[model samples]
Target: MSNMEDEYDFSHPERGVAVIINNEAFSTPGQEESDDRAGSSHDAEALDTMFSGLGFEVHRYDNLTSSAMVETLTAIADMEIHSKSDCFACAILSHGGDDVIPDNTPGAVLLERQDYVLGVDSGVVLVASMISIFSDTRCPGLEGKPRLFFFQACRGTNMDPGVGVKVRKTKVNPDVGPPREGDGAEQTDHKDAEEGNVDIEDSNVETNYDSDIDNTDSIPLRPVLSVSPSNINKDILVMYATPPGFYAWRRDTGAWFTQSLRTILTPYNATYWSLTTLLTHVNKRVAVWYESSYPGDTSMNEKKQVPCITHMLTKDVYFRPKNMKHSTLV
Candidate 1:
């Protein structure tokens, strides 16, 4: 076998590619502009720098509609680069909503499109369902390769009420309810207007249902390969900025969780830390920062948040600097 097939070395500049889907403004067709993710650009810049420092080629897409995001991922899954690479990574920054689609169908709470009620991006694409696009069969070159996904978005409408303390209280944001679409859809539908546009280019299709949704009333007699997570998500690692049903906190500079991620993955830190250990550190640090907040009367004290990670990695992973030679999974 060639050296490429024998071992995986992330230090090599061509060993992998990382894509960043940075959605700053969520202005879908016929919808008023959604709330601007004030500091997302900084978050994107930090991610680009962090990945580049680790020696991976980076591709960034901005202001994409749902269709564009899907097209981009589909195209990447078909790229020749994976055959020559050790791994792949994708980072998505957007607003998240509940699983209420236009047809009252349940979908992932990620990505918004026009007409708040309708699912776009060729239909409603759930966050959990995004992985199938890079299945071992669909993207053969990526089989057995690490696919890391980082998400910085809200998973639900609930906000952290923050623990009560003896300290003086600050003015809290009045419960304005969740964001919403212009047509008086539920507040949760507002989430559909953010991220990229849903069906700007692929506007012809009205309801692109997520593949996970089963329309049949009868059970299938034959077993499907992608039905189970273990079978299809072999070498994947997903890290969310916040736990399910929570809002991911971001400041003027960037997201506290991702910023902490940058610190833990840095060369100086990774030499001694494993990927599992690094994520633990990120979670703890983020929680502590949120709890601290602004001291004194104006403080939103005891607000707690935790990062969540799901992995199916068979071996341990330790990130190494570009110039350093380190252990690779067997």
Candidate 2:
């Protein structure tokens, strides 16, 4: 593996991006529904803090039309299919189903299958494909930059209660550990500081203290565990609002996770934290705020909503701009 620090670049054309899609309205059968702009304004300010000077030009747009969704993505992807450019990051806020959004446009822009996966993912392959267009043509000054996506919408129509809190990391007792050296470890995902990511392995990274023997397959399948080769997009990271089979909370007037996300990014100037560290703080802030908002709501106290971060960064990311010195990672 290449050393993460060695991947740094002094000149980045675009610092990075935080595309916030506040879908506050939807078109339905000749009818239109407006979402809360108050929440949108709140979330936009939050995302802007994270995007500003992160390594790309910060662009902001209101809820897009159904037709505009695909078209907009196509147009932007064309800008940097490949080259040593700044990274890509986006935040989507909308009423969601399985994998589609009801943009305020005429026809609801349905998403592709690959985009349905967890963590700031959605029609991302299409965006990645667009990046390939530039790379294939050997586009000058725009290749190898990471593409990060942050999605804050429900994956499916269904909504079930989610596990909102964790007293601590769950673990198995050593007394119950299985005894055997060849048993190997189970497949798992783990985080590393240098790479600023949580990587998946063919074998689980977590330990089952109850089992004395590791249960993982000794044979390495780098190809299987790594992000599919079919996806050439490199250094990508996605941070999602919640997990499957759960409700990503939103108030009639405010977006729960989004509001907190902005709180962390905008104030105190925290741009130096890595992707993992950012999410870790995000998870904490979101959970704490949710708990406080509904003081009387019992279920709220029990459940903790965390941002599901899917990271694939090359080098460490700071909580604040590397060039600028900030006392606190806001």
Candidate 3:
């Protein structure tokens, strides 16, 4: 293991490779240029700058087809650089949604949902497919190393109409006694505790579902391995721009999630704070600081977005300062 007691090692000369896939234009047969993503280039550029500043070898790919996307990732996973690098990171900015297919069981009617990103040609690429390419058995060079992925796209067609917060001022009676066991107050406390536990477990659940896509072709299922590798998905992290069944907001300037990420994960912060700490800041910023403000569409106004982060890292991950020299491994 290259890591210390609780932290992943970043003492190698090469920090790692960072890949940015930006899909700004849609060339599907019936889709218009209006469907083209207007501000995705800004996201791509910002990620490139931010990752490059972190001592990564950044590779940027623009407007690739679904097949091309897979090929590109396959080539990267086959590279020898991972043996010497400390981690891997990838950011994808594109139109994305859920891939729904009708289950073909006799007298059964059901729709299966799979998450995917759109290629420029309107072809779909499953997010899971991309992650599987870097599994331990497939990309041995990155075994036990952190693999980070960031996705900026709409998860579904649902628009969030933020709930109004009402503040009620009430006077408390001085004669009121403290709540006893089995009272309303005690039940409320227990409920709160249960909710707190649910919140913690929510981070590990895969609840995100992308918005609708126009493609009619059925999405192929990933083949199940008869024997799964123990470390197949050991040290991976995936972050999405929005919660399940919600639209990710993007202005003409840039995407809400990417902007917050670049702002929060600066070199100074990266050196002192864990990656999860920085992402928590990013989540807070995106959820609180942004809201949809379309004047013509009242229903779309005041919408909120919250990013979701899931990780399976066995140790704390940190990005060292770019100028810092490699330290002797413990």
Best by TM-score: 3
Q: Which model is ahead, 2 or 3, in terms of TM-score?
A: 3
Write down the lDDT that model 1 would get.
0.57
RMSD of each: 16.4, 15.5, 13.1
Worst 10 residues of 2 by lDDT: 211-220
Give me the overall lDDT of model 3: 0.69
Local distance difference test, per candidate?
A: 0.57, 0.44, 0.69
Stretches > 4 Å off in candidate 2: 1-10, 27-38, 53-56, 80-84, 99-142, 157-233, 266-271, 291-304, 319-330
- Candidates 2 and 3 compared: the better one by lDDT is 3
Worst ten in a row by lDDT for model 3:
188-197
Per residue, candidate 1 scores C-alpha lDDT tens digits across 95-159 of 65334223233774333321110022323345655677887888887888788888877554344
Q: Which residue pairs come into collision in candidate 3?
A: 97-210, 97-211, 98-210, 155-210, 155-211, 156-211
Best by lDDT: 3
TM-score of model number 3: 0.74
Off by more than 4 A, model 3: 1-4, 27-33, 100-112, 166-232, 322-330
Q: For all candidates, what are the clash counts?
A: 7, 49, 6
